[model samples]
Target chain A: MTLTWDMQDAKSTDDRDVVLEVKDLRVHYATPLGDVIACNGISFKVYEGETVGLVGESGCGKTTTAMGVLRLVQPPGRIVEGEVLLDGVDVLSLNEEELRRVRWNQISLIPQGAMNSLNPVMRVKDQIGDAIQTHESRAREAVKERILELLNLVGLPARVYNMYPHELSGGMKQRVCIAMAIALNPSLVIADEFTSALDVIVQRVVAQTMLDVKDRLGMSMILIGHDMGLQAQLVDRIAVMYAGNIVEIAPVEDIFEESLHPYTQLLIESIPSIKERKPLKVTEGLTHDLRNPPPGCIFQFRCPYVMEHCREVEPPLRELKPLHEVACHLFEEQDGKIVDISDESVV
Target chain B: MRGLTPGYLIRRLGMFVLTVWLGATLIFIIPRLAPSDPVAAMVSRLLAQSGSVEGSAEMIEAWRARFGLDAPPLIQYLRYMRNMLTFNLGYSLTSFPSEVEDMVVRALPWTLGVLSIATVVSFVLGNTVGALLAWRRTPGLVRTLLPLSFTFTAIPFFMLGILLIYIFAFGLDWFPVSGAYGRALTHNWNWEFVKSVIHHGTLPALSIVVTSMGFWGLGMRGMMITTDGEDYMILAQAKGLHPRRIFWLYGVRNALLPQFTALALNLGLIAGGSVLVEYIFAYPGMGYLLYQGIVNTDYTLIQGIVFIMIMGTALGVLMIDLLYPFIDPRITYETR
Candidate 1:
């Protein structure tokens, strides 16, 4: 884990405004086949009151990274090494008792699969109330008031308070989940695939609700999802992940306009936007098997402009502009020369 | 809070009629189809009482007509159902004119007392233990208990009764091996009679509880295990609720739903009594009476016992269907 990582070239962007800073987060799952490196040394930061979208296709460790942030990774899948600093406190260093205090009060997760997440036998209000009452001793009326406030914030009616999970529609359940996530006013809320399960109409409503709640409550959020279009609508900055690694991190407009990484460009092009309706640029090759990933770049096999050195060593994430980083040899600065990777490496 | 829509109630009541009618039809046909003519059996027993050398043909016909057995099978079935519905089970053929209703009344308390206590005790013990086992799942403790509980369920009901009687009654001289109470304690509301009833009921109740508690425990344990791993459970943990509250309230409460319905249905069938277990212990419960009814070809008694059982089961099913929705907010009695 102490392997030499080349971050000296890039200026340290760690600031007081950073709500959460995850450094070299690695998570591995011991399956029957082999150890699957679900998240491999992925690092990112979420600024206070800013929504950072972790975008990737399925099985690319996007969700794993979110789990690492919340310290919710369970048995068989262990967070092997990482330093998760939330508000400058290392959450990873906290023991079980301390983690409980940190979990819902400081950082909560609106988990994936909204349909199966809430307790079917419990009322939605109690579900939210339980999260509140767990950390603090509050009067019954006080808890009820807080639950009502949360429900209102998520755009759900007060009538939904007494209803069970099964009685609610998918959209309502997701709202309840979001309500629970924000019940304690956690400084950071991670919504994993918050709207993926819903149809287009419900997705838009849920996305709107997410924005409203985030803006109103003023909490940093990490929205992990597969839909780039949906992520683009909600997040200020997007981190594009590919096979347990983030290939690019840039503002949403910058990613859509000019992406330095080949994978990022391919991902942006793959989105079927009405504005970018030129042609369907199909990304070729297959996703890397996490158990037996290649020695060099995980995206090298799928890169349209693959180079010799791309197959030899992995490129480190480097800042090409302020707050924009790209992990590709194309952006590398060699000695005093800005190496023309386009002429030498474009295949 | 729809309060069970009228449509669901009426529909369920209609189904109940169908079920009871089916039960009555089975009872009506089963005796007629049997080789032993109950009329003939009653006639012979009657003739023997009178010290007749051989039953005359005329006498047999007279007795058959008197009992309405000479009519067509359909008319006889109708008459039988009318008698059953009116709670007049007629005279027991083997018991020599003793009303089947009276005999049933005499035998019911013995079975109910033993079984109700056993079922309730075991249900409480099994479910609590099962939940604890699921919550505090130490591998070593589970490894030791899993096999023993499974083995208890594997042992046949009567075999376990006999084994209990051998170990606790005949060997240890701890309890009476047979009968409802002490012979010296006359039937009364006195403490001695009640104490004797409980004292004698111990072995039979123990057999029932010991054999079937394993089922409830294992069922609840399995339910807890599956429900424990569910998304709601993870959500509970993420909620940062205390571990104890989560285990009992969220974990066991959901797990206990299936077991609750099962228990209600089983307790509903308690009217039928533990047949072989009661017979082995000689606790003259409804099961013992039913056994005697079958052996003596007492169709009236058999029909009476079976009707009670059918009614009990139907009521149990109906209660679960309608009342369970009220018990569990997840269930809805509204017509889909």
Candidate 2:
């Protein structure tokens, strides 16, 4: 539940400050059956001017976690426990008026589906201008100039401002989305699968633009995606989530080279690379049903090296190395039994 | 860009021709096949007026033959189609000197005016209310009002029209009981006439509004509910868009697309008019003209009214279709 980052180093070394720090965040959806624990006690820190990669499988609660951070959860899904501290302010505790000020000013989000995300009736420029005008009491000319600047920053021409969402290409639309997200120079940007819908080439362009904007604006980001390769390319640090829990938190290099958790190890190994033609190693079984999760480790059902004790008790995230934490029974004991299996048995 | 493909234009023209042919056939055949003799009805009306059967059966048969009622159903249908294509809707039996097209021209504008105004009023008010309800975290009073509005929508337009007439006309005496204008104003286009027209029109307009607004509100509310959950709406909120801006621009704007299509459809019906509303208000519109046509079995007048209604609907749909690309460039015939 505790997240400790070198704040002094992060502030002094980087132009971007520590924008958002989520501690022991727990979000659950109340369903007819019962409460489905979507995000169960997760913690991470996003420093200013850096992109933190949140990589997980489809049902690993990545999107839910993002929505919870924004407090945009619809009825039945609520943030049960969490401290979403944005620039030292607890976003969860703010009143509507205070939260309204904080939301678009401190943090902005680039949603997953760029294609049908825009209002079909409105011009692209107007949509961006709308964002600016809503947050700030600016003159029309100033807002228009800012919108054009944002559009240009995202590699869109000034002409696109007059065009409706449907007129723009997928890449253009995504850029418009990015422009919208960065309109107010928000301290932190949460892009939930923003580039997942684009082709690889477009995805790369969008991802690069995001990084470029972050660098220029000095805004922090949480880039959520399932592609490990994409995450490795964009994010400075990676938090690999598995079944509502962050099993591994480390720098990009450590996650790939010295992955401690079995889930993180499996994820790293599964990334298709040019150097190796080995078949991808995938984690076995589906994500555990959150409504009635087993008493022990949620990943125990899918873990290849699950022991008898693993099914009886849960494992706490313990620091395996400097700035690297892993939550798994394999790393729980000093001399835990080590078992090696090929890709066939694991799958 | 050519705006329309050649194939699309050809297909549309072909459909238009087919629709007209079908309409002509149905109008001609259904009346003939109604298991009642129009000649007998005409004869009965003459007898009722004269209080005696002065003409011979042969004379009555000759009159029927002159009108082409003596022909077989299929032949009659084909003849009607030919006349329709040539813009010759023939003479009204009830009003012999007046052509069907003339009667339609006289009555069409009134219907169009009433229904068009009603349609526009309902769309704007309903959508605005629905969007507010969807977006605002308003108090219980506003929330309670929404269900009542929905209840108004559930009632048929005719029932609502009657209710409005009772309350506003009979009970309150605030508006005229019937007709488009007061007798005192008498065809004048002055302020007095305008005021009287507005007064009389209120109950009818209210009837249309109360009946139809609910559908639009419900539609807009539902659309907002779904659209509000969309990622972009959340993105807008995260962008620190003021709550009102988020609702109107992000939430309602996107939600209005489908409602626009529905509104377009309703606009098509404006020329046709609300038959029940017209009857209740005794409004001199195409709806009442249609009523007279049916009651008198005025074949030519009915055909003319039907043709005009068809053309109005076709043109409305076409206009809406043409406007789609301008509104949302992603939409196109090719995409479908």
Tens-place lDDT digits, model 2, residues A197-286: 899999889888987887788778899999998888888889989878888888899888867777887887777889869986766787
Query: Model 1, range B55-117, lDDT digits (tens) per residue?
Result: 467877987898898999889988887887798888887776699899989998888888899
lDDT of 2 at B151: 77
Docking class of 1: medium
**For chain B alone, what TM-score does every candidate structure achieve against the true structure?**
0.91, 0.88
Question: Can you tell me the DockQ of model 2?
Answer: 0.50
State the DockQ, from 0 to 1, for candidate 1.
Answer: 0.67
lDDT of 2 by residue, B92-139 (tens): 889887888777777777788788888899899999888777764656
TM-score of each: 0.92, 0.85
By summed lDDT, the worst window of 10 consecutive residues in model 1 chain B runs over B136-145
Q: What is the lDDT of residue A269 in candidate 2?
A: 78
Real contacts retained, model 1: 0.65
Q: State in Å the error of residue B152, model 1.
A: 1.2
